[model samples]
Target: MSIKKNRLSQNGIYGPLTQKTLRNLLKKELITNFGFENMHIIADILIDRFLKIISECSVEKERIKPYQTIVFAVDRNQRFGYGKTMSQTKLIPVTVNIITHQELEELASGKYLKDLRPKIVTRILKEAYAQGGVLSLNDVAIICGVPNTIIKKAMRDYYKQHPDEILPHIGTIFDCGATMTHKRIIIKLYLSGLLTKEISEKTNHHPFNVDSYISSFEQVRGLYEEGKGVQQIAFFTGFSQSLVKEYIQIIKELNQLQNNNKPNGLMSLTS
Candidate 1:
C-alpha cells in the first residue's frame, strides 16, 4: 500500500477550519467520552502536546535530511499505534519521518554513539601519553570528539589504572609552568657537572633548549668571574663555548660601566 506523507508546519499553527474539520469527524465520539466542556479542553491539550512532539521530531529530521517520513498510527481506541497494521476498529494512521542526530551518526558510521564513546576515550589516552602526558582536557576533547568532562573522567580512570605513568602536572606549549620545570631540571643537571649532550640525553630535550635554560640567568656570569674559562664554563653549564663567550662579554661590559662611573683620581683626593 502506498503511504501518504505530510510536512509539519513551521509556525505550528493549524487553520481554524482544520480543527473544525477534525472535530466534526470525531465530534460524536469525543462528546460521548468527554462532556461538552471537557471536549474542547481535551482537544486543546492533545493539539498542544502533539505540536510540541512533532516540532522536536521535525527539527531532528531536518538535520538528518531535508525531508523524511516516519510511519506511525493513531488508534481511536488505543490512543497511539505504530506501523501500518490495519486496526480492527476505527483508527487514525500517522507517518512521521524524523531522524535524530544520533541516528544519523550511527547510520553513517555503522556504529552507535554509545559504542563509539569507548574508542574516543582510548584515543584520548593514547594521544595524551604520546604527547608525554602533558595535554589539557579541552585539547584532548577537541581532538577526540569527546566532551571535556568525559575526557577528564577518562583521564582520572586512566591515572588510577596507571598511576606510575601520570605526569606530575599538565603542561601545554603556551604555558610557562612546563618551561620553568624544564629549566629547573636542566639547572640541577648542570650544577652536577653534566655536559650538554649528557643533560640533553637524560632530559630527552633538545640541546638548544638546554643551552637556552643555562644562558637565561646570571649563573654563567658568576662562574666566569670565578676564573672559569669559556670551555670550562660550557662543560659545567651545558652551554656551548659561543654562548659562554656571549655571557662573558655582557659581564665585562657591566664591570666596565661600573668602573667608569667611579670618581676620578682628583675627586677621590678631594674627598
Candidate 2:
C-alpha cells in the first residue's frame, strides 16, 4: 500500500498502516470452522507476539516482522481491547461481528469499509495486488494479528468463488503432486538433523534433490566429490543454478583465504 510515502514511526503499539496491513491479512484468509470466540483469542495472542518482536528493533532491520493490531480493532473503540477491566475481571474476547461470509467478501473487495480511513483498507488491497489476486490464508495470517483459524475462515469465503482446483491445506502453496509432498516431508526430516538414505528411498526423490533443498550449507562442503556438478545439483534440488554456483564459489574462496592465512585482503566474491 501507499504507506504515507514516508518512513514508518519507530515507536508505537502499532502504526496506522501496520494496523491496516493486519486487517488485510485477516481478510485475505479463508475462515473455516471459526467464529468470534476463536477470533478474539487469536487476535490477543498475535498482538502479544507482535509487541514482543517490535520491541527488539530500533528501526526497520534488514528483515521485517509482522504485526496485526493496527489492522483490526480489538473493539469498536479501536483500543487494545484486552487485558483486565477496571473491575479486575478479564474482558471477554472482542466480538468480530462480521458474521457472514458475504460481509467479509464485500469488505475485502473494498465495497464495504469505504467510509473508514483509507489506511484501514489499502494495505490488504496492495498485498492482494502484489500476489496477483490470490492470497492464501496462511500467508495473510502470518502478517495479521488474527489466529490461523480466523484467517482460514476468510480464505474459505474466497475459495467459494473457485470450485474447480483442489483446495490446498494451510501453509502449502506448491502445486506439485503427492510425490512432491512426500519429498518435502523427507527434506524436513533431514533438516531436523536426520541424515539417512532411507528417507530418500521412502520419498522417491533423488538423494541429490533432497540434499539440495535441505542442506545447502552441508552440500557446499561436499563440493569436492567427483561426478557432482553444482548446476546439475541445483536443477534437481529446486534451487536456482545461480545460487548453487554462489555457494560453491563461496566454499572455494573461503578455503583459499584460510589457507593463505590472510587477515585482511581483497576477497574474490562480488556479493
Candidate 3:
C-alpha cells in the first residue's frame, strides 16, 4: 500500500507549521469556528502576522519535548547520577516546569538579551536545586528563554577563563570524578587572584557567601604562612582540618607557580 503522505493537514509540504506552531492551530480555529473553509486563503493571511510575531519571540521551553517533567534528587549523602536506580538512594520528587512565562518575563529583554542568558541558566539551575530537583545542562537550557546553543555560547564566553568552575547542577554537583568540589573550585579561583564578586558571578554564588569563603581562606592562609600546623590553623580559623589543608595546599601551589614564573633574581608581580 502507498503511504498517504499528501493527507497531512498542510499537504505535508509546509511541515514547519505542523501541530507544533501556534499559527497552525490558529488556522484551524479560523476554519472550524469562524465558518471558513479548509482551503480558504483568508486563513493564511490572518495567521501571517502571528507567525511573524512568533518568529521574533522567545519561549522558556525552546526545543524541549513535553516542556516539563518530574525529576528526582538523591539524598545529600548518596551518590546520584543518570545510572543510579531508585532503590539505591533516597529520592526527593521535584516538579520542573520548563515553559514558565514568569521565567521568560524575569529573564529576557531586548537590550540585555545576550547579557542575561547565562544568568538565566544559573537561575534555572538554582531554582530546580532549591526545590530538591537536580537538572542537567539540557534541562536548564530549556528554561533559559533562548536556543540551547545560544545559551551555551553565552555561558562559554563568560566562563572560558575559569572552565572548571562549578555551577549547581547534577552535571557538576553529582559528578565526583574529575570535577572539583564547589568550595575547592572557589578557593582555587581565589588563589588565582579573582575578586570576590567576580568569583561569585562565575560560580553562581551570592556575594555574601563568596565573601565569607574569602574571609575563611584569608584566616587559613595567614596561619599557614606563619608556619602553623593544619590542626592549629583549623582550630584558629574555626574550620575543618581538611578545609584548612586544602587552602594551604592551594596557597603553596600558587606560591610555587609564582616562584617558577619569576626570572633569575627577579620577583613576579602577576600574583
Best by the lDDT measure: 3
Tens-place lDDT per residue, model 1, 1-271, is 2232233442235544465654354554556666655667776666566665656435354344443332222221221123423444232323322334555667697876554454445554333334333334554565555677776576556545653232322231212232244454555566456888987666645566567666654567667667888888899888768667765664564455446866322112111
**Which sections of candidate 3 miss by over 4 Å?**
1-64, 67-163, 170-180, 191-193, 262-271
After best superposition, candidate 3 residue 126: deviation in angstroms?
A: 8.6
Candidate 1 RMSD to the real structure:
24.6
Q: What TM-score goes with each of the models?
A: 0.25, 0.21, 0.39
Error of 2 at 128 (Å): 25
Q: Residue 265's C-alpha lDDT in candidate 2?
A: 42
Evaluate all candidate structures by whole-model CA lDDT and list the values in order.
0.49, 0.41, 0.63
TM-score of 1: 0.25
**What's the CA error at residue 198 for candidate 3, in Å?**
1.9
**Model 3 lDDT, full chain set:** 0.63
In candidate 2, stretches whose alpha carbon ends up further than 4 angstroms from where it belongs are 1-214, 262-271
Residue ranges of candidate 1 with Cα displaced over 4 Å: 1-138, 144-179, 218-271
The number of the candidate with the highest TM-score is: 3
Q: Ten-residue segment with the worst summed lDDT in candidate 1?
A: 72-81
Candidate 2: tens digits of C-alpha lDDT, residues 167-246: 32212222122213333355335534456575544443345555644566455435424447876777656566766665
Q: State in Å the error of residue 30, model 2.
A: 19
